[model samples]
Every structure is written in C-alpha cells, then in structure tokens.
Target: PFPSVALVGYTNAGKSTLFNRLTGAEVMAKDLLFATLDTTQRTIRLPQGRPAIIADTVGFVSDLPHELVESFRATLEEVGEADLILHVRDIASPDSAAQAKDVEAVLEQIPTPDGKTRRILEVWNKIDLLEPETRETVVGQAERLAREGTAAAVSAWTGEGIEALRDTIASLIDDDPETQLTVEPHRGDLLAWLYANGRVTGRETDDDGRVHLTVRLHPAALGRLERLYPDVID
Candidate 1:
C-alpha cells in the first residue's frame, strides 16, 4: 500500500502553500481563515522516489462551528488513517506555540491503531515571514530536531528546504513488510540498521563481500534504509 501523509495545523498556517509546494497542487492560498474548507489530496514522490499520498486537511480554527466540524469529519478520519502527520505551523506567528498546542489537542482526539501515538513531524513553516536573526534561530531549532528525525523547517512560499522536508517525511512513515534484501558485506552500517529495525529471518554472506538478508521492517526504518542505501539492495 502507498504510504500516506496528512498536513494539519491551525488556520492560516501556510498549509496551502506547503501543500502546493509538495504536491504541485494549486490549492487557493489566502490570508483569510477557513479558505480551505474541504480536504484535498495528491500523490507526491518521496525523496526515496517512492510515491505517497499527501492530504491537505481543512485548517483548524479557534472557534469552529459545529457544522464546520461535521463537514470535515471525513478529513479528520483521513488524518487518523495517515501513515504520518505533518503538523504544519506558521513559525513566525506570535501565538505559534499556543497554536501548536491547540493543533496537538486536535491530533490527540484522532484514535490510532492499537492506541499507539500517531507518528507526527512538525513542519516549522513560514520562516520567510521572520526577521533574519529570528529566521536563523527558527531554522536552527528545526535542524536540531531534524537530527532526531522529528521535524523540518521551511519557507514553503519560497521553496526553501522543501527537498529536505520531503526527505524527512519519507523518513517518518511507519509500515511493515516481510521482504528480502541484500546488503554488501562492507556495509556493516546497513546490516546494523536492518538488525536494529527489523526481524531478520535469514542471512548468508557470499565470498564476494555481499551479505544476503531476509527481514521484516516496519515501514519508517525500512524507508530510511531504502533512502539512505538503495545500492545495498540493488
């Protein structure tokens, strides 16, 4: 199955801009709230060249009408079905932190399979709206989180860091496959990751410095493996 990602955030967080940048869709981006009342989705190529569906969800508002909630019920359920959730935020907004908390509150209501916490990645977007010094700080914080594989920073309007964001989202999807892949004997790093992230059912090393492995990887780690080291399998 194709992995899916859902974009969710407080209203006017530049999600439409990010959505357009990611999927090449022309969702009308407006400064006004509730501009995107309906959810939109498109298939986009992840950095690893795998295709995944990215959903642009209706933005959340502070005082949403009950009818508005009813209208977006399907979108919220899509969020629940997503393999990854990108919590897009207007990082330059004055109330951004609280806005993030509110978005988090909504995500909390979405039940997950087996009640596991839904995998989420914070998209710290709209850094272009910040002052130079502040932009540096915001991007720096995002890079730190990127190291942990949890967040990304970008100015979706300007296209800055969009590639990295795509890579990060690919790095965060969760899935499992009973599959076979070969690792070169020289690539101990790949072997370690396979062992750490998946259950290895079979292995054999050939004299030509190649190691064959049969493993089951839950998707996120498998994606990282494929993204970072495709040649090992090839």
Candidate 2:
C-alpha cells in the first residue's frame, strides 16, 4: 500500500481546499459545514516524484453527537490508518486554538493501528485572511515550526507557502534508507520507478545488460519496490 496522509480539522478550516491544493483532486471545498462528509482520497506527488495517498475527511465540530459518530466510522478509520496527519487550522479564526483542542479531543479517541503516538503536522491555513501584524506573528511561528517539521502556514486559496509545505511533509515522513539493487535490462519500468521514488546515488550497466543502482528510498517506497520487482534486490 502507498504511504498515506489524512487531513483533519475543525469545520471551515479550509482542510478541503488544502486537500485539493495538494492532491489536485476537486472534491467539495465549500464554506458549508460538513461540505466533505465522506473521506475522499487522491494520489499526491511530492517534490521528487514520490507519491502518497491523501484523504480528505469530514470536518470536526464541537460537541459532535454520538449518533453522528457512527455515521463517520470509515472516516475515523481512514484517519487512524494514515502515515501522517495534517491538522488544518483556520489561522484567522479567533477560536482557532480552542477548535484545535476540540479536534484533538476526538482524535484522542481514535487509536492508531501501531499503538504509537500519531505524527500530526499542524497546518495554519487561510493566512491570506490574517491582518498584516498577525500575519507577521504567524509567519514567524510557521518558520519555527517548519524547522522542526511540525507546522506550516499557508493560504491554500492563493497557493502561497505550498512548496515549503510540501518540503516539510516530505521531511516529516522520510525514512531515508539506502539500498543497492540490480535490475535486469528487461525491467525498465522498475528502473524508472526507482529513479522517480528514490535518490539514485550510483548507476552502472554491466555487459550482461543489467543496471546496478545504489538508491536511497523511503521505507514504504522500498517495500513497494521490492514487492513490485522481487528479483531486483537479489
């Protein structure tokens, strides 16, 4: 399975807009509550042609009903299974911090499959709405957050700070394991995937027409490569 990301946040935090911005998939990104009721996913290609699946989930609200909870089991499950979680926040909202707590309250109920603390990257969305003074503060905070791979400030609407956001996401999820593998000349498809999904440090073609490659890949990508071409590594 591809590495996965889930977008979770309070209603009208611009999570859906950010989702569309990242994945280039047009799902409902309206101002209405619960505009994205179901979990929608699309493949997102990162800076190096590495791909991951990103899911846009239903927006969270304060005091969600128990009955409403049952209706969103799938969305909850999808969030639980994510390799990374982007907690989108409406930075311009007066109650943004409180809303973040509300969303976290619900997230605490959903157990991750691995029983480890989930890696959540805070996304400060709708920065375009911030006043100039407030924007300066948020930008400073974002820069600090970016250093730790913990947060990003962006206006998904204007596409501002998106490239930086992508770089942050890549860094946060990187496994960075390097490997050596040889590919038969016949399996050029596998060769292409390795170059796309990984950093190829060395390459050589033998008289036998096999391509030897020294590559650094994320663990998830490496596992997928191994599964896709079992003979390459041996």
- Best TM-score among the predictions, by candidate number: 2
Which ranges in model 2 have alpha carbons more than 4 Å from their true place? 184-186, 195-212, 216-231
Candidate 2 per-residue lDDT, tens place, 1-234, comes to 457889999999999899888988788888888998888989887766556789999999997776677788878988988889999999999999999999998887777887655899999999999999999999899999789888999999999999999988877765577799998989888888887778676789999999988887877777888788886775
lDDT over C-alpha atoms for residue 181 of model 2:
92
Work out the TM-score per prediction: 0.73, 0.87
| Candidate 2 overall lDDT versus native | 0.86
Candidate no. 2 TM-score: 0.87
Q: Which numbered prediction scores highest in lDDT against the true structure?
A: 2
lDDT of 2 at 224: 88
- The alpha-carbon lDDT assigned to residue 47 of candidate 1 equals 55
- Candidate lDDT scores, in order, read 0.81, 0.86
